[model samples]
Structures are given as structure tokens and as C-alpha cells.
Target chain A: MTAPQDNPQPKLGIIAGGGALPARLASAAQTAGRAVFVIKLDGHADDPALDEYPNVSTRLGAAAKILDAMRANECRDVVLAGKVARPSFSAIRPDWRAAKLFMKVGMKALGDDGLLRLVGEELEREGFRLVGAHDILTDLAVSEGVLGAIAPDDQAISDARRGLSVARILGQADVGQGCVVQQGLVLALEAIEGTDEMVRRSAKYRREGVGGVLVKASKPQQDKRLDLPAIGLTTIEEAHLAGLRGIALLAGGTMIIDRAAVIARADALGIFVLGLGDEDGETNHGV
Target chain B: MTAPQDNPQPKLGIIAGGGALPARLASAAQTAGRAVFVIKLDGHADDPALDEYPNVSTRLGAAAKILDAMRANECRDVVLAGKVARPSFSAIRPDWRAAKLFMKVGMKALGDDGLLRLVGEELEREGFRLVGAHDILTDLAVSEGVLGAIAPDDQAISDARRGLSVARILGQADVGQGCVVQQGLVLALEAIEGTDEMVRRSAKYRREGVGGVLVKASKPQQDKRLDLPAIGLTTIEEAHLAGLRGIALLAGGTMIIDRAAVIARADALGIFVLGLGDEDGETNHGV
Candidate 1:
């Protein structure tokens, strides 16, 4: 491995999961004048924009190959972005190296948090320091305070605070990152079906008043560099579909995949965005 | 509120949900010399052996009348037990009193957790002191240690530890209590579908020597005086259906309704029962 020259813009290696975040992160990294390396995940990470990266790559579920490529290409920092669903557990065909590692663990190790911890641990063993997605892409780190045009009323704000607390608690449990709460009630909590599905469950609850709050946060012990909670246009679209009025997030911690685009979508949907701060903030209480 | 007199054998009011717990608790309390005023939750509470508690009286969903009977009978300690589900959000006719209270909150505030919290808060406001179902029936709490004739194999133990950690984290988040882990992979997390359904999902990924660990815990912030995480014959039956080997529960903290009967069933099914300490325990290295 070469002792690479220090480039002002560090290249970002995106170990992508399915959905729009990988493409969004890639674009964001490019805008920051850094080379983007896309080691797209199997079945989940065949993004069309991979070709646009300075060094696009592919590997079919082999941890060794994944580490090799990152090290060989001098990619010092990496982020695990987007969804890697639990149902994919049965579908995964681990390669020789992946199988050896797999044999060391059991089915319970396949949950997002377990697998993520294992992945991050495996990387650290190879001498790579994992960094938060926001460390490399600051613009994507969701800003504190509102982003969209609509200012939620006091009732909506209260609901958002409540929802945010429940949602953050869910993340800490490693159960999920999103929950829809309105007027001190929880309409839905994201589980295996994920955020979009949880939001949809709220529709059947007969929304009244300012609707529910959609809160997302990083899991208490998550490997931040690999996965930061992200929201893009689709999230806003789904929130609107679920009859939600506001979104609250852990400020400066979670990532907004495409800030301008997500803000624009939120604006179009007339949703409020609040960067929930840890201190002096209207706290969302957990269970 | 009148200063309650010290009555060692005070009559107890039990809001019986579905399961054998109420019936068992009734017997235990009788043995302890206390009369049981039971409000059997329709469709959920078990059909007890009527011969067992001939004089034990019950009510349907009329919370007001039940409270009246308890007060008249001097039953100062009210214990909510069993698993009558939170009234359905879509099609519940909350009797006049529940309706009047429910009217103050929007539909978004009626998820199970929200509704339970509201009910407990309301009950506290109305002068009833909520104690645990096992308050006078501590004999019914699962023994703190490895139970059953069989112990979980090494792999199962690892998953159980992971399941315990995740379950507690979820508890802290105020999410549901149950989780399934197999071979270190998280197979299913209990959500709105609840515990039995989660076990069924884990069954899908079942393999020999891949026995999953199922853990159910009370959320860290939960008020244990009410809404304790409870299990019964149904849980043991579900473990068999899901091919689980180890069942981890928070030692001393969680309540097992009908503890003796539940253990009998679990023993028959060869499921390992573990009352885990507050901290997650280590696993055997290998089978």
C-alpha cells in the first residue's frame, strides 16, 4: 500500500446499501472535489451513478475483497449508507472469507447493529479508523433548526418532541430510527419494515389536528462513519403520504443525504424540520 | 386520599388481561390470605378453573364500576395483570369513562404504549396506587438463574446475550420488549405485530444448531408498578413453534405470569429459562 500524498479533499469509499443515499452521498462527495469509490453492496447497491465516480468498484459480499480494495486504492475513510434489510439475511451467500467470519457467529449476529459492529470491528483490526459520514461531508450533516417553510404550531412541536424521544429510544434499542407520534400517542415505530412502512401505518390511525412527528436519530452505539440516519426526497414524500407535519432529528449527528433536494421536497410538502439539540432544547422524553 | 391502614391481607384489584397469570395470581394471593377483585379482560383473560376461586368476583370493561367495587371492598392496591391488548385504535368502543378521557387526545396518541401511559397517569390521578402484578405474589416471579433441565448451547447462549442487550436497549427506547437472535444475527424484533409474530419470523431462518434466543424485557424507563413485561403458556408455545432454545428475561425486574405453569410448559418443551442479571452475561465460547 502506498503512503499516499495528502489531498485536501479525501476520497470517500461508499459501502452502499440499497436506496438513494449512496447515489446522494456520491454526488455530495463529488461536489466536495473528492474522488468517490463505490464498492456497491450485492443486490442492494447497483446504483446507476456508480459509473460517475472517479474509481467505481464492485464486490459480491466478500469482506476480504472489500477491505483489500479500500486499502489498495488508498481510501482511508468509509461510510456505510442506506438500508440493509433483515430479510436479506436468508438471501446472503457469503464468499469463502465471509463464510469463515460467518461461521464464527450465529444468526443473531445478522441484525443491523450486530453486523455493523462486526464490520466496524473488522475494519479497525485492519488499521482503518472509521469516521462519521458527516465528518467528510459536512453539508450532508443535517443542520440544527428548521429547514422547510412551514413552522409547526405548538401542538405539532410538542408531538414532534415526544415522537423524537420515542424514535431516538428505538434507535438506542437497535429496533429502529423512526416513530410517528402525535398528541402523546405512537401510531407506528419502524421495525423490520423500516421507516417508510412505519410512516404508512400512521395513515390508518385516522390523523387529527397537526398529524404526527417523524423523529430519527443515530443508534446509541452505532458505528457512525458507516451509517448516519439520512433523509432525502423520498422520505419527505413518504412523510406526506403518512399525513405527518414535521420532522425532528439529532442535530449535527444524523446526515441529510441531499440537503438542498430534501429541503426542497420538505418545502413542497409543507413539512417542518427541526434539528433537535441535546441541551437547552425542548426534550423528547424516552420510555 | 385517605391514609391507608396497614392491612397485610388487603383485597387486591386485578385488571386481568389474557393469560394464566390472573388465575395463578388469584390462587397465590388467596394462599397469602387476600381476596382478589378481578376485572377479567374479555377475549384475552383466560377462562380460569371456576372451582379454584369460587368467591372471586369480576367485571367486564366498566372501569368505573370495577373501581367502585374495589373501593367499597377496601381493596387499596390495584394490580393490572395479564395481556388484554390495548383497545384497538380503529374499532374500540371505549366505555363512557375511557371515551371521555380518550377524547382529550388525538388518534395519533393512541398507540399501545401511549394509551397505557395515559391510563396509568389517569389512574394515578384518580387515587389508585398501581403496584406490580407480583406485588403480593412474588413466588410467581421466575427464579433468577438458569432454569429448566436443559441449558442453552454455546451458540444459543451468544445469541441470548445479544438478544438481552438489544431487548434492554429497545426497552430504554420504550419500544416493544421481545427480540429474536440466532447465531449472532437478529432475526426479528418485536414491533406492532408483537412477540408471537416475531418468533414466527425467526422460525423462517431456523437451522439445526442455529437455535435462536428470544428475549423479552421491560423498557428501562417503564413504570414497573404497572404494565410489566409478562409471558405465559403462549410464549413457551411460540418458542417451540419458532424453534427457539433459550429464553432470556430480566432477572427480578420482569414478571412471569403463572410462573409455575409457564415453567412446566417450558420444561416440557426443553426451552432454557434464564433470569439474566441487570448486566448482560457472557456466552459459552462454543458448543
Candidate 2:
């Protein structure tokens, strides 16, 4: 856990999945004067820009190759990034290394968070340091305050608070990351369906007056390095189309991809983008 | 509260909204030699069969007219039935009597169960006894057993148990009546969008395996006299389309409309229809 400044920083091993965040993280690491090596997930990490880094395309089940590649490149600090839907057990032809890991974790590996935690433990046991995506890309972490010009109205705030409580419960069960609430009623709850589809499904249930609010937060017992809640331009566009009033994210625990563009879109659409402070103490924003 | 056989039963007052339940109840009462008067909510109760009985079509907000019509028809026992989407306050133009009732209930009338309880109290104050739809249509109340030729496999039973726990938590908050779960993972939860949409939404999240299960239960502290959870042919068809294995309802608390036809359709589709017993001791049959 020593800071990079305290010793010669090891090459960052970026195990990339799908989405822009991986590429962004690689660029950030390189800009910080740390060499980067990426093991792009074969079918998932489709970003062409990832080719610029000293990288190798590998299957998620090819754990032996992934670990060897990281070792060969002297990459001790690894950061797993982007979206990867859990591959069905039938679909994954795990190598001996992955099969051994699966056998160790057993049925507990089926859950999203549980699998990630086990995988993190495996990586740590193999002598690799796991860094959170937020740690390297600090600017992407949402801060407390309304990001855009518009702030949530009283009704939207109430809806967001309700959504937060629901989302927290769902997360505690390792179910979902977000929910939509409107006019003191829960319009929809996200489960296996991703946030985009959940927002779209909620449009049909929209009541009159101030529209619903989409709220996302980290699981109370979440491992920050695995999957911190995230939002981007697509989320903003979808929220607008769904007739939602705004979006709320857990401050310091949620990642905002392309914050500038997202804020611009939110401002143009008159959608409030709020960053809720920690749940325990009530200091920062009005949220 | 006296049994109909114990005394000369008063004329039944039917506060009909929308759907077949109202008409079915009217015919059942007529067969039992009880006079019935239907106060159909205008714009909602479109059933033409109601015209065969002593009835009046009145606006929901016209409380004076509705009560007067029932009293003039010598109706004392009342049954509220069928689907009625809560009309927004702006959409409902309440008469003075209705307005006074709303004032008395105040903001508590905003929720579905709360509003029903308040209205039921007002009706009782007017000297009318509120009877449950299930009490009159005893055959419709689900019994603890598996209906249809098909029975749920181990996987679907596990999914139903998972859905039941989630649904109960949601019900405690007065949030929803049902949820869909697959392979121990919650797929979708019903809220304001209703069970039909929740099933349709869950279809996209279907995993490769023995499909999901839809579980419905009355709220743990639900007023059964108001809205008891009910399923019909549409539920069967929707579950089939959603790639779901079966449907489970809380035995005794849930109503099955057109039970014979529902069972026949379920058998034809090879979908299991299960009646879950009270959540206490071991059930009569495997859940």
C-alpha cells in the first residue's frame, strides 16, 4: 500500500473490459510517467486506442496467459476496468488456473461482487497490487454539488432520496446499481437489466408533474476496486428521453466518464446532475 | 359481519372499476338469490354486461351521487373490485363530498393502500359493510397445491423463493405485488408499471438455463378487503413469452380470475401454476 512517490512505481497492468474508461485510465497512467501494459479481454475490450499501449488481447478464461503476460511486463500494479457481463459457466472454457480458482470459490463465485472479490484475492495472492480506477483517474470521481447549471427541485430531491434507499438495498443484495422514483412512488427497480434499459422501461410509468430521478450508489459493503457505480453521456441522454428530472450519484464513489461533455449535455437538457455526499454525516451539499 | 345464511342478506352494492371481476361477482350474487346494485365508475367500468342489473354509471369524484344511488337501490354490503389506475389529483374533479373526504384523508390518500383504507372507512361510516372480493368468490382464492400438469423444477422453485423474499420486502414498503427471479438472481420487480410490464421487462435479462419464475403475494400487512393480488390468462401468456418456467401466488391471499381457463392455458403451455402457503411452518406441498 506504499504510495508510488515512496518507491519506484511498478508498471500498471490494465486488465481492460468494455467502455472508454479503460483507455482513459491507460492514458492517465502513461501521463503520470508510469509505463502501462493492457490485457484487453478478447471480445469485450473493443477500443482500438488500446492498441497504442504495450498490450496483449486475451480471453477472460485464459488466466494463465494473463498472469504470465503481466509478470513478463513487470506490471505489479493492476487496475481492472470497464463493463464485463458475467460470462455463463457454459460459455467460459477456463484454463487450469481459472478452473482451479473456480473450484476454490465454488458456487459463491456466481454473484457479481463475490466473483470480483475472489478474483481480486487471486490477483493479490499472485503478488500484484490492485489499484482502483478512481485512484488513477481522480478527476472522474464525482464531487459533492450539482455539476451542471440546474439543481434538482424539491420534488426531484425527494425522489432521489427514495431511489437511493432502494438502490442501497438492492446493492446490499448484490442485485443492482440504480432505480427510478417519481412523485413519491417507485417507478422501476433495476436488477439484471442494466441502467439504460431500466430508465427506458420507467418512461411508461412516468406520472405527471416533476419527472422521476435516477439514483445510483455504491453497495454499503462494496469493494471499491471492482465496480464503482459509473455514468456517462448515454446516461444523460437516456434520462432526458425517459422524462426524468435528473441523475444522482454517490460522491467520491461514482465515476463520471467525460464529465465536461456530460455537464454540457445536462445543462442543455436542463437535467440536474447531483453528487450525494456520504450517508452518515450531513455536511456538504443539500442532497 | 353476520353470515348471509344467519340473516336476510342486504342488497349487495358493487363499486365496480374496470375488468371482468365486477360482472362475474354480480352474476354469482344473483345466482345466490341476492339483489345487487352496480355503481360503475364512469370512463373506467366499460363492461356492458353490468347493464343487465340495477346500476348507475357515476364519476369517481361524484361521491354524493354514488352513495345516494346505492342507498336508493337499498344496497348495504359493498365489494370493490377490478383494476383502477389511481387518477392524478388534477384529473379528478371531486364534488364537495368527495373533496371533504380527500381533506379528511389528506396527503395519506396519495398511496394506493392508504387511499383504499380511508375510502373504506368513509363507506363504513355511511353504514355499508365492506366485503372482500375473495369472500364472495371463494373458488377464485388460490389453494395450496400445484395446478396444471407441469410442476416447477428445482431451479424454478429456488428462483421463486428468492423472488418471494424480495417481494415481501417491497410489500413491507407498500411498493409492489410481484417480482421475477432467475437462478437465484432477481430480474425485475413490479412497481407502478404493474406485473405485466415487469414480466415483459424481465424477458431481456433472461439467462441461458431453466427460465425465471414470477412470484406474487399480498403485502405482508395488506388489507385483503381492498386489493388482493390476482392473476389471469394474461399472466400465463406473459410468463410464457418472458421465458419463465412457472407462476407462484401466495395461497389464499391471491385471486385467480377464470381459474379453470387459467389452469387449462397453463397446462397447454406446460407452465407450472403453484400456490405458496403462508410463510411459517413447512408447506403442505413443496414450494
Candidate 3:
């Protein structure tokens, strides 16, 4: 196995999925003075903005072709960003390399994180260093403290803590990463349908006077490089739609994509966007 | 306190909520040759069918009036049936008896089961015996077998087991009692929004070739006399609409309101409705 080069300008590969995160990662890599090579996942990466980068489009199961493209561009470091819907087993038409890896991992029943770790190991075995998008775009990682003018009140803070605790439990089961808690009661839990829909469904359960809080956190045993928990402008919009008082994300464990836009939107909606620290003991409003 | 007499015909009281279950329970109790009295919860019981029985309408927090009405008719055995939405704290205008009980139980922070237990204790103190709705309506209890011709395939059974396990975990937390699982992945967990909406949302997460299963079970520590898990014709309809292959419910623990209608609907939709036994070991697809 080869170690990643200590060269100041190592070539970076971006495996782009749907959403703005991939393009942001590409832009960040370019700004960091590194050569960028992008492999846009067919049917997932339809962003016309990605055309600005040097890229090739390929299907998800064509692992050999993806590796070949990366190697052809002399790329050593790789980052996977954005949303990739889990395809059913029948939908996977894996190439020889991917098929072998799938069989080795007992792909028939592996959860999301399990498949991700297997993919990471396969990438490392092919001599590519797996890096988190946060490595190149550090600003995307949420920082501790309130991100907007409004701060969560005592009730909202309590609900956020309850929500984060439930999320951890769900994460431990390898099920989900987000939930909405209102007045210390869990109103909704995110599963395969994703966060936006969960937020939308929470509207029916919202308390008469008390608003809920949305909590998104990384899984306890997740591969950070593959799929860190993320929230963006859509999250703020949805939270507002759900009549939630705030959004609480795990600090240093979640990605806040389009940070500036998120904060501005949260401020306009009078919603607090808080980045909770590791300790769940006390909530310092930090007004 | 008066011990309930084992007399030939002790009058039964039915605290009715929304839906056909209350009316069905009233009919069943009447058929059993017991005099029936009903206290319909104001907002929840809109069924005109309940008018067939001698009944009085009262608000949720008017416990004194409910008890008075029951005792006025010499009713001793009581059954709470159907759906009652959680009222906000400020909306609860409890009478003296309910106020005392609420203070004794710290009702403001209690979960659904906790509050139900406290209410049961209060009723017992007033010489009323709280009985499960199933006790009077034995036929409403789901039997251990598939209710329709179609059976859950191996994948669907596996998902049902997975969903039931997750639902148990959520139940232990006093959170939810239902979940949708497809191809070994949990699609959604029922929380405050109720079962029908959860089933609707699961439709968005259904896999390409494999449909999911809805699992409803009793919370491990819940009171059997209060809020037992229930399903009705609406469940079968929603499960079909969600593209679910089947429904798995805990036998003897779940109420199947309008059983004949439910079974007919499941058969017409080609959906399996299996009553899972206490042991989650094997799925007996008794067609």
C-alpha cells in the first residue's frame, strides 16, 4: 500500500453526487491550488455547474472505470460528497472490481455505513487516500455556538438535547441521523425518506404554543470521510415550514453546506441555528 | 372503596374516542347481555353511531363529570377505546379529581402510558375497575395467523422483524409503536403524527422491486387497559396505498377494529395481515 504523497500540490479526485456540496468541494480544491479531477455519478450528478471542472460521467457500479479515470488523471486523494440514494440490489450492475468487493463485504445485508466503510477500504487498497470534503472546505464544518442572531430558548434547548439523544440511538441502530423534538417529546424521526420530508411531516405534530427543534448528528460508528451528517439551505426552509424554533447540529461532526446562505435565511426566518458541542450536559445560550 | 361485584350483569362503561372501535365495542358489550353506558370524549367521538347507546358527551379534563355520569348509571367496569389526540398542557382544564391526580402523577412531564396509568389508578380509587376494550370485545383481538391469501415473502418478513425490533426500542423510550421497513432498511418510525401518515411517508422510501411491511406492537411497559395498539380498515387501505406488501401486528396485543371488513380489504388488495405471536422467532404465514 502506498502512502499519500507529502507533495504540496497532490492531485485530488472528487466523486460527485447530487446537490451543491460536490461542486463546492471542487471549487474549494481548485482554490487550495490542487489539480482537480471529477467523476460525476451518472443519474445523480446532473448539476450543470459541474461542467466547469475537468470531469467524466460514469454509472455507480462501474467501479473499474471510475478507478481508471482517477488513475488516468494522476489523482491520489479522493473525496465523496453529497447525496447518493441507496440503490436496490437488482439495480447494481457492478463491474468486476466492485462485484468482488461487494461479495467480500457480504453486500446482501450491509447497512449504509457498512457499505461505505467497505468502499473506503476498496479505495485505499487501490492506492487512493480517502479524505473528507471538510479537509478541503473547512468552513463547511459547523462550529460550536449559535450561527444566527436568534438563540434557542430554554425549552427549545431542552427539546434539542432530547432530539440529539434520540438521533444517537437511531444512529446506533444504523437507521437514521435526524429527528424533531418538541417540548421534550420526539415528534418525528428521519429514516430512509430523508430529513426534508421528516420536517414536513412534523407539521401535523407541532404543539400549539411550543415549536420543535431539528437535530442532525453523525452516527456513532460512521466513516466520516464517506457521509458526514449535513444540513443546507433546504434544511432551514423546511424547519421554517415545520414551525420549528431552531436547528441543532453536532459541532465538528456535521457539514453546514452553503453556510452564509443558511445563516442569512435562518436570521430572516427568526430561527436559531445552533452547533452543539460534544458534551450534552448544559446548553449555554451564548446570547 | 367498593369492590366490583361478580354479579350476573354488572353494567359496563365505555369511554369512547374517535373511529369505529368505540361503536363496535359498545355493540359487542350490548351483545354480551350487559347494560352499557358511554362517555364520549368531546372532540374525538364524532361518530353518530355512538348515539345508539345511552351516552353523554364531556371534555377530556372533566373527570368529575365522567365519573359522576358512570356512577349515576351504576357502571363498574370501564374500557377506554379509540384515538384521543394529546391535549396541550394549557388546554387541560381538569376538575378537582383530575387536578389532584395530575398533581400526584406530575402529569405535565408524563408520556402517554404514564398518564394513562395514573388515570387508571384514579379510576380504581373511585371504585371503578379498568378493563381492556378487548375484554368486552374478544373478537377484536387479532388471532395468530395471516388474515388474507397473500403472504409476506422472505424479504418482507425480514423487514417486518427488523421493523418490530426498532418499534420495541422506540416503545421502551416511550416514543412510538409503529415503523415501516423495506428490504432490511427502516423507512419511517411513527411518532406524534400517528400511523396513517407514517405509512404515507414510507411510500416515498419504498425500494424498486421490494415493498415494505408495517409493524405495530405494544410498548413493553404500557398498560393493557389503556391505549392498546390498534388497527382498522383504514390501516389496510393506507398500507395498500403505501405499496406495502403486508402488515405485522402483535397478536393478542393489537385490536383489529371491524375484523371482517379489515380481512376482506386485505384479501381484495392482495396484502398480508399477519398477527405476530410473542415469540418473534418465526413468521408463520398461515394462508
The candidate that achieves the highest DockQ relative to the unseen native structure: 2
Model 2 agreement with the true structure over A71-90: per-residue lDDT tens digits: 99999999989877766565
Cα deviation of A259, candidate 2, in Å: 2.1
B10-66 per-residue lDDT for model 3 (tens digits): 788898888888888888777766778999998888789999999999988899999
Q: Judge candidate 1 against the unseen true structure and give its global Cα lDDT, from 0 to 1.
A: 0.68
TM-score computed on alpha carbons, candidate 2: 0.88
lDDT of 3 at A44: 84
DockQ of predicted candidate 1: 0.25
C-alpha lDDT of candidate 2 relative to the true structure: 0.81
Query: Where is model 2 more than 4 Å wrong at Cα?
Result: A1-6, A100-108, A111-114, A125-127, A277-287, B1-6, B100-108, B111-114, B121-127, B278-287
Q: Model 2, residue B176: displacement in angstroms?
A: 2.2
lDDT of each: 0.68, 0.81, 0.81
TM-score of chain A of each: 0.86, 0.92, 0.93
Q: Write the per-residue lDDT of candidate 1 for residues B1-287, one digit (tens) a residue.
A: 12344665567777776666677677777776677677665566775652355333443435566666667767767777767554554335566776677778665446556566666777777787877766767765655678666677777666777777777766655556778876665566665556787687678756555577888777777777776777767888999888888788877667776677778889888998888776764332111
Cα RMSD, each candidate: 6.5, 4.8, 5.3
